[model samples]
Structure formats: C-alpha cells, structure tokens
Target: MKTNGKKTGSGRIAYRKRDRVAYLYLLPWLIGLVMLQFFPFFSSLYYSFTDYKVTGGMNWIGLDNYIRLFTKDADFHNSLKVTVLYTLYTVPLKLTMALAIAMFLNRDIKGINLIRTLYYIPSLFGGSVAIAVLWKLMFLDNGVINAMLTALHLPNIQFWGDHRYALKTICSLEIWQFGSSMVMFLAALKNVPKELYEAADIDGSGKIAKFIHVTLPQISPIIFFTLIMQTIQALQNFTSAFVITNGGPLKSTYVLGMMLYKEGFAYFNMGYASSISWVIFAMIVVVTLLLFRSSSAWVFYEDEEK
Candidate 1:
C-alpha cells in the first residue's frame, strides 16, 4: 500500500510537470491575446461609454454617442446607405464571377495552372494603397479607359469625378479581386466525386443538370463560407474609398468604415468612433448569425450524409 501510494504521487507529479511545460508553450499566445486582441476589445467597449478624445481626458457619457448616431448624424445614415449599396452590388457580382472562373479553371485544359496564377495575381494586391491609387489614375477623365473610348470615337466618361460612376468604379475594383473566392471554389469543385458526374451522365443529365444537381450541392458549403466572408469584407472596406475617391463625388462612395475613420482619426471623436465600431461589430455579428441560421437549409456537411 505504501509503494502504491508513492507511485501514484510520482505519477501525479509527472503529470503536473507536463502540464507546466504545456502552459509554458502556451504563454506567448496567451500574452498576445490579452495584450493585442482582448485588451483592445474591452478597451473599445469602455471607450464607447465615455466621452474620450484623442489628446484629452475622458468623462462618462453613457449612451449619448449612440443616441446621437441614430438621431442626429446624417453622415452616418448616408455612409450606411452607401455601404449597404456597395455590399449589395459587389458581393453577388464578385462571387458569381469567381464561381464562373472557378468552373472554367476546373476544366482539364492546357496551361491552366499558368492561367490561374495570372488571374490570382490581382487579389494579392487588391487591398493595397498602391493598387487603389493605380485604379484612381486608370479611371481619371483622360486615363487609359477614357483614352481607349476616345480612340474608338466614344465619349469620355468621368469615372472618378462623377457620382454616378464613382461607386460603380469601386465595385468593379472589388469584383476584380475575386481570385481568393475563385481559388476556394476551385478546391471545392475538385473535391466533388467523379463518380457522381458519371452517374448523372448515365442518367441522361446534361451539363446544366449535372451542375445543378451534383456540383452545386457539393460546393454549397464553400459558397456559404465565401458569402459570409465576402459580406464581412465588403462592410469593412475603407482603403479603396479613402485612397481612390476620398469619399468624394458628393460622398457617394462613403462607406461605414470611412465614417469610422473620419470620426476616430480626423475628428478625434474617439468615444463616438468606439460607438460606431461597436455598431459595426454588432452588425457583423447579426449578419453572421443570420447566415448561420440560414445555412442549415442549404449548407451540406459530410457528417450530415452519415
């Protein structure tokens, strides 16, 4: 009995030593989470409840900023409208284009890898300031697009200077960066079983029929993932509008992100900006929840089949 008790004690000591080593390994990550992610998260929440400024002290203000946002801020309303419009225009078009290209790339064709790489290059630089600046230059009144139109005896279009075309120009930029979604779709497409297609063919299923009945069902989960990710991305888009249009042309391209930036940095309304940030966070959470709720009806999992 004494020997057995000693053995058990030693085993527990060894287990504790192992646990200590594991905790040591996890220490850096825990530190980073608390310092970088969690601190900012809770700090923003606290800031939202105070009248914080960039260079001055803060006083407790409760829900005043949030109330002002809904009641008095016309710019907030306009920015929200523009953001919703941008998301509505950009997300579906981007996903559709990505899926179409993914389908094309899924075909067993020569030089397909090279073509895929070429197509994917735009996404690598899509969110960069340089690309936004380049896009701005390209859409200028006498820029390449307009010059080509002029050469073809077509009238010049003010892509950046005109409100009608400014937002659409930004949407086109977003759509052009569909490579990430395309690659994901391509991966999902390849996972679809060849036997399914063969069986469908035997059952007199045409190309469209096979796609609808087989390909779509197999890739629906990926589609759902891309939809949620792209929606979140579209809502948080700021770099292009800031670098390209500066939310100009009558603020037609002003998005919620830009509003957040202006309120936080430009105006030094940190408390109000914190409130906006929380609102954006809440919006994202609600949208994500809605997607998750709807996903059960559409998104198929391998485990579900079992």
Candidate 2:
C-alpha cells in the first residue's frame, strides 16, 4: 500500500509537471490574446458607448452614437446601401466565375498546373493598395482598357469617373480576384468520388445534368463556405473604393469599411466610428447566422450521410 501510494504521488507530480510545460508553451499566445485581441475587443465596445475623442477625454453618452448613426447620418444609410449592393453583385459574380473556371481547370490536361498557378496569382495581390492603384490607372481615360477600346475603333468608357459605372468597376475588380475561390472549388471538385460521375455517365446524363445532380450536391458545403466568406469580404471592401474612386463619383462606391475609415481617421470621430464598427460587426454576424440557417437546405456533409 505504501509503494502504491508513492507511485500514485509520482504520477500526479508527473502530470502536474507536464501541464506546467504545456502552459509555458501557451503563455505567449495567452499574453497576445489578452493584450492585442481581448483588450481591443472590449475597449472598442466601451468606446462605442462614450464620446471618446482621439486627442483627449471621453464622456459616457449611452447609445447616442448608434442612435445618431441611424437617424441623423445620411452617409451611414448610403454606405449601408452601397455595401449591400456591392455584396449582392460581387459575391455571386465572383463565385460563379470561380466555379466555372474551377470546373474547366479540373480536367486533366497539359500545362494544367501552370494554368492553375497563373489563375491563382491574382488573389495573392487582390487586396493590396498597389493592385487597387494599378486598377484605377488601368481604368483611367487613356489607360490600357480604354486604349484597347480605342484601338478597336470602339468608344472608350469612363470606368471610375462615371457614377453609374463606378460601383460596377469595383465589382469587376473583386471578381477578377476569383482565384482563391477557384482553387477552393477545384479542391472540392477533386474530392468528389469519380464513381458518382461514372454512374451519371451510365445513366446517359448530359454534362449540365451531371453537374447539377452529382457535382453540385457533393460540393455544396464548399460553395456555402465560399459564399459566406465572399459576402463578408465584399461587405468589408475598402481598398478599391478608396484608391479607385475615393468613395465615389457621387458616393456610389462608399462601402461600410470606407465609411468607417473616414469616420475614425479622416474625421477623427472615434466614438462614432466605434459604433459604426460594432454595427458592421453585428451585420456580419447576422448575415452569417442567416446563411448558416439556410445552409441546412443545401449544404451536404459526408458525416451527415453516415
């Protein structure tokens, strides 16, 4: 009994020592979470309720910032409208183009790896300020696109200069970065069982029919994931609008992110900007929840089948 007790005590000491080592390894991450993530998260929430200025003091103002945003701020409503419209236009267009290109690239062919790499290159630089600036220059009066049009004896279109085309130009810029989505779709496509396609072939299914019946259902989960991600990204888009149009020919491209930047840094309305940030966060959460709720009707899982 004495020996057994000693063994048990040794085991407990070993377990405690292992736990201490594990915690030591986790210490840096915990410190970072507290200092960087958790602190800012709660501080932002507190700031939202106060008239916090960057230069100096803050006074508790309750929900005045949020209330004013909804009621008094016309830019808030316009930014919301533009954000929703941008999400609606860009997400679908980008995902459709991605899936289509993914399908084409999924086939076994020569130089296919090089083709995939080339297609994926755009996504790497898609959100960079430099890319946004280059895009703006390319859409300018005598830029590459207009130059090509002129060379073809076609009238040049004012891409970023006109209000009607400004938002669409940004959408096009986003859709051009469909490489990430394409890569995801291609991966999902590769995971789909070949037996399913063989069975569809046996049934004399057409290409479209096979895709609709076999391919889509199998990859529905990935599609749902991409849709949710792209929607959030579109809502948070800032660079293109900031660099290309500076929120407009007529505030037509002023997304929520751009508005938030202008409010926080440009205008130095820190408290109001915090409120706007919270609103944007809430909107993202609500939309994500809605998408998750709707996903049950479409998204398929192998585990669910099992």
Candidate 3:
C-alpha cells in the first residue's frame, strides 16, 4: 500500500508537468485573445460611455451620447430606419432567390458541377471593392446598362443619382450574391430523405404538395440558420453603400455601417462611434434573440421527430 501511494503521487506530479507544458503551448493564443479580441471588445463598451475623440482624450459623458442618438440626432434616426429597410429588402429576397436557384440546381444532370461553379463565382467577388466599382460604372448615366437601354429606345435611368432607385440598386447588388446561400440550400436539400418524397407520392401528393409538406419541413433548420446569418450580414453591409453610392442622393443609402464609418473615421467622433457600434451590437443581439425565440415554432429537427 505504501509503494502504491508513492506511485500515484509520482503519476500526479507527471500529469502536472504535462499540463504546464500544454499551458505553455497555449500562451500565444491566450495573449492574442486578451490583447486583440477581449481587450478591444470591453474597451469599446467602456469608451461608448465617454466623450472620446480620436485626437482629443476621453471624457466621461454618462448616457448623453445614447440620449442624443435617440432624441436629437435626426441623421442617426434616418440611418437606423434606412438600415432596417435595407435588411428587410435584402434578406428575404436574397434567400428566396438562393433557394430557387438551389432547387433548380439540385439535379442529377450532366455538367451540373461546372454549372454550380459558374453560378458560385459571383458570390466569391460580390462584396469586393472592384465589383462595387464595376457595379457603379455599369449603372452610371452613360454606362453599359444605359447603352443597352438606349439601344432599346428607352430613356436612361439614374440608378445612383435618383434617391428612389439608389437604395434598390444597392439591394440588387446584395441579391446578386445569392450563390453562397444557394450552395448552403443545395446541401440542405440534398440531405433531405428521398423516402419522404416517395411517401408523399404514395399519398397522391403532387410536386407542390411534396415540396410544402416534405421538403420545407426537412430543410427548415437550414432556412432558419440562413435567415439569421443573412440578416446579420445585411445589417453590417458597408462596402457596397460606400464604394457604389457613398450613401448619396439625399442620404438614401445611408446605412448603419456607413454611419458608423463616418462617425468613427471621417468625423473623428470615437466615443460617438463606439456608442453606435454598441447600438448596432445591441440590435443584432435583439434580432438574433427574437429569431431564436420564434425558431421553436418553425425550425424542424430530425432528432426532435425521433
């Protein structure tokens, strides 16, 4: 018994040494998380309460910034409203297009892989500065689209110049990048059991019936996930608004992200910017929570059925 006790003690010491080595190996990641992620995250939260200018030092301001944003700042109100509208316009339309294309591509046809690759190519560069620039150029007064319109004897459209069309143009750019969502939808569609469709057919269900009763229930979880993700992405959209319209035509495209950028970098209102960032963060959290709350009603799981 004495010998066994000694052996156990020695084993415990060896384990401690191994754990120390493992901790040493994790040092870099720990340091990075502290300095790069956590520190910045908390610091922004703190800064949001202060009047911290980029050039001028931080000064404590309580809830003045938030109060101003809610009441006094019409620009903030407009930006928030525009952002919400943009999110509403983009997410559903984009997801619908994605699901449609995914359904079309979900086949055992030849060269389908090549076709998918071609379709996915747009999403790869859709959010890029170059693509935004190209979109801008293509929508200009004397651009390719207008040229085509002229050939058809139609009057030129002011896509970027007109406030009514500017936001829609940006929404179209976002919708055009439906390839990623389509791929996800395609994967989800493939995973749905063929047995379900066969059972539906045995019940004399038509294509539409099978789709509604069979396919949608099976793919509901993926749809829910995509909806949440796409909503978040649409809320944070900046590159298209900045590079294409620059929130132009009477600030029609002035989204929350562009507002944040202007507040932070352009105007050097670091504290105000941090507050805006937190507001955006809060909005995302609330939206995500609402989705999760609503998900129980719609999102289906195979395990739940089991």
Q: Show pairs that collide, candidate 3.
A: none
lDDT per residue (tens digit) for residues 228-287 in model 1: 999999999999999999998899998999999999999999999999999888888998
lDDT of 1 at 207: 94
Show model 3 residue runs off by greater than 4 Å. 1-26
Point out the higher-scoring one by lDDT: 1 or 2.
1
- Candidate 3 has a TM-score of 0.91
Q: Which whole-number lDDT from 0 to 100 does residue 116 have in model 1?
A: 82
Global lDDT of each model?
0.92, 0.91, 0.91
Q: Tell me the spans in candidate 2 whose CA falls farther than 4 Å from its real position.
A: 1-17
Ranking by lDDT: 1, 3, 2
Residue-level lDDT tens digits of model 2 in 222-249: 9998898888888899988998899988
Give me the overall lDDT of model 2: 0.91
Model 2 residue 23 lDDT score: 76
TM-score of each: 0.92, 0.91, 0.91
